[model samples]
Target: MTQKQDGDPKSLSAEEAKAEFLALQERLRAADIAYHQEDAPVISDAEYDADKRRYAALVAAFPELEKDATQLNSVGAPAASGFGKVSHAVPMLSLGNAFEDEDVADFARSIRKYLGLSVQDPLAFTAEPKIDGLSLSLRYEDGVLVQAATRGDGSVGENVTENARTIADIPEQIAGAPRILEVRGEVYMSHDAFAALNQRQQERGGKVFANPRNAAAGSLRQLDAEITRSRPLQFFAYSWGELSEPLADAQIEAINRLRSLGFSTNPLTRLCSSLEEMIDHYRSIEAQRATLGYDIDGVVYKVNDLSLQGRLGFRSTTPRWAIAHKFPAELAWTRLEAIDIQVGRTGALSPVARLAPVTVGGVVVSNATLHNEDYIAGRDSKGAEIRGGKDIRVGDWVQIYRAGDVIPKVADVDLSKRPESAEPYSFPHVCPECQSPAIREEGDAVRRCSGGLICPAQAIEKLKHFVSRGAFDIEGLGNKQVEQFYADEWIREPGDIFTLRERFGSGLQQLKNREGWGEKSAANLFDAIDEKRTVPFAKFIFALGIRHVGEVAGKDLALHYGEWSALTSALDAARAAALAHRAADEAEDAERIAAEAEGRRARISETRAAAIKACGVPNEAQAAWDDLVGTDGVGPILALSLSDALANPEERAAIDRLADHLNIVPPDAPAAESPVSGKTVVFTGTLEQMTRAEAKARAEALGAKVSGSVSKKTDILVAGPGAGSKATKAAELGIKVLDEAGWLELIG
Candidate 1:
């Protein structure tokens, strides 16, 4: 048998696969929240898509992961709590991505296979410029606009009817239309409007958007309709969410009908009869990307025949009838001036490339992330050669690639242009800010500072994160303010924010008497701080800045544990078990390592047997570890990290100190009385009545846990047409199987 490659997902141990899957889930979920709910994307389109593809591959390599793959089915973050939730009659599904010409061809092939079309049979498709903007759905009844919503979580969205009515391109009334129609499209900002808005924001000392997409989203999602009206936003109607009558039997005609009915549509749309035509259109749109005066990340291809689209059906998160052909990342070459290291909140030392100022993807870049020391050494963590193993050096020419607002990255280094005096720069072995020894652990790619709380860089960054918008969100407390307070020794940690007023309110060094402060502004800051004295438990967890515990994990943990006492109880139980196991495992490890050091092969071999006996914990203690790991999103890796963070003397003290000053409230509970409440439900094959996303949202609303696969834990399986192995497995496991009709009746 041929062996798989070293880094292949298929070759990963069962434990490794589980750990990596959970991490990928966290990464994707965080990116989704940032992109959809926050209106700010943390990673580039390419990186997000790559992570998604990796998730898909891992699931393929190890099918057991599917049962825990709820993240794969998520469309976007849930609708913001600020607005009323509007459930879409027909879910607004996301389109799958196609990055290469082959992917496009495969998409066509899959469509043909689903339709049973012969190779000679002509297949028609509609190709349009995929606008880089926010998705919106406008509902009209009797030619009068009644409601509008953002495509939040694909199924339920935020009601933004008043804001949508203000866009000039979106007509409030149409002359002739069906009694009920839900026109769907994008809300975007033109390049000119984006620049002007940024300039205005700067002049007014307000937040500046990173890109036109962010600007448009921020403008449209404003609670005040007057604020949205004042912003120069535009709309383009390209699809429909729910319809009373069919506009046309084909995709192109439907778009035309939308345009005729007084809605702006993308003019670059074209009908393609073959896969070659689709690729050509994609290329053509990409060529015009820079000159279009607006952002278009890619081209979207859709099945031309509406009936064929209906037949193609939908996946959990995307429609099978459509795919987006994304463009490659924009790249430019620049001279590498220097390499610097920056310590993060986690004490990880990250290398940064200082480049001669050059524009990449319309953004001037003087710096790019070097990822870690291995990357600077021209090798990946696995020692695989990258960029032909040509190490990056100072004064060498490097190619920087940037995708939109994401940080620019050094893509390649040109050895031919290297200066005579250029050197392979030595990565620092200590923290640059504090001179603390940086230690690189086994299997870890980056060296991290060992100074812990004493490292000023780590302390400052953690403090900054504590007050960020997603965390405590203290008003008038930005990064600069946090740094200034830290440098002055007035505030050192998160808890210090709560003590500031008590410490300096009446003294000559009062915050009001400080530079950049006045009595009114100071009072407002204190009021903001006081208002945040009662923080939601999820925010508090995220504000702790624990490694591997992000906003998503915080929400997961909050949902799992419900209250502070229960969470702490679980942590304590797990910690005791973890300590017992660690001590035993370390003793066994020491014996085995010592045996190997003495070249005692037989003794080393015997340690494997001894390790098993040594590492075993009491059943009750083992159950504690299992209980924490069983939390839907937390795996062995994150569970251990969370346990260690709680076990650390200093970190635990800091957390408790911070908690003492705040009243932590639990998140709103899900519906608990529904039939599917607390039960695991799985959906397989194609549902005839509604899309997969809609079914999932409905099930979740009833407090059911919807999984992607059938297993012993699955309480119910909603099987539909073409149900295969999952259906068989559900039957084998005696899972309650329901057809589409039965599922609908039960839910009703």
Candidate 2:
């Protein structure tokens, strides 16, 4: 019988303790399932793991918990009979874990020692983040997702077909036929999405998820396919289960094949030529972990050579070919003395958690990001603080730690550690820079200064966003260049970009006479600028730099609005609509009681309607906007940003000036009767004829806008092999879905 720990009730019998342990196991397992399989976590990973470890300890202390029902050795129950069980075409396995650098080096030594290779012998590996999420086996016959199963019991698992289809990162079909492929990988959530989801959950009074891994698992396990569809779950393939015929000689080659097939493989994956290089890769990942926006426990080192992996294959549960070098979890307790608001590059007032220094993962932590006042204050009925700690009052002890070591956040406050003389913090009601009233836009979490077109911080960020890849994608103008220009007073706003030639003309001529900026390079730059001038409506929209707008959104906006002139006019109106929309939607009929109801409602409704309508492209002018949005893979946030950029009067004038400076001709329209002229095409499935990215670019060259998803009005769906639900949906909606050959024929 499992014995209870010191905190257990003294009256409890031995059998009762065993029963409680078993009950705890079941409860925790259910929570894990909710986390790993469902993409909705009921508890935090820390809480779940802690409970699991406690249960394990109890079992160890009292042998009663070791009975068949409570033991950890039970194979992951029986495979759910939803799909026929197929023996792993190639066995899906786990990796051995190492908590520190020494452990990682030890793993490397073992690999070398086991293979009887000398210290000088070449040993290569492909290192990727050991993502914390559910593991699955994806089976493909000739490059299509035929079946996918959970990594239940290392043997068989529930067949989650309908749910898996919702994941955007998973490929339904692969390019170039590879007889069979059984890929293994972790499904996870991006940090941005995870935070957004948690926020939504908290707003709705639902149990908040602790981390992305748990959220991903819980989302994936949702019995309702529609529920799964709503979650933001992404999958990254790290290895394969089986291959009837090997596609690559090395692990790197195999991964390249996967990337070519439209799967979003980790770009950071590297081929370490030696053990030292492998260690270098691990260190690099560790440094970058916090910035990656995904959680990784450690780096997974694999034997790159396929032949070597085969020779080193198979342990009962894990493979000898790969090992996991886990970085220690970054968690620490710090005394929170106060919270301060800092102005962001965008004029956003960000709440910073100030704390007494503490150490975690060898880094001293004094300040962590609270993201916004709303986050620190906690939403209440009247936008007041609900947690009694408004704006993180001074002298409160705060817990500080890095989530995945990428985001430093204040997890909690230790009221007991707070000083008796401490006072509640008062949040600033005015902008720290321009003294403008800082207004929290309806439905927005961050408060911002309304000094648009004037705020230096906002201007700089806008300009930066303008030249960003997601925006105008201006070459030769990166962050450093933007900052230099801003400091030198060469540019103030996004519109100032067009004035670059004027400011640089004399200087550029001198530079041309100097070493590097010769005629060729200068000419190349001018040519690049000219090329950008006749920008696609979509790209122009993305360059606008709007809050809550991103590249994809920009395309949607451009596709919706069509012309620069129309988009600007619409966005001007949309800005008004946005305020009204939020005021109306923030809560029930409370819109009536909103202090600034009339002003807010009128402004927001106008802005939002324009923005939404801009996104939808409801008419011919809109269709012109939609044409830009239709550019394959454009998203909503980008679309909004693009709309805002073009809408700005200063930016428009700058474009006009740039247009005059270059005397550049607009892009020539496609020839009449051309197959792709002015058409909207969305590509899906496995594209064997060409790389998916290449195909989209080619389509753009032919004047056909490529869209990401199938819509009722889509002119065509470029259906490659393994065309699944999208193709079927297209057929149902009467949209044409073309295979690779069909597409080639059309373009020809």
Cα lDDT tens digits for candidate 2, 513-535: 64445877666665556567666
Per-structure clash totals for the candidates: 0, 75
Give candidate 1's total backbone clashes.
Answer: 0
Indicate which candidate wins on TM-score.
1
The TM-scores, one per candidate, come to 0.78, 0.44
The regions of model 2 sitting more than 4 angstroms off are: 1-245, 248-330, 337-340, 378-391, 469-481, 504-537, 556-748
Global lDDT of each candidate: 0.81, 0.62
**What is the C-alpha RMSD, rounded to one decimal, of candidate 1?**
6.1
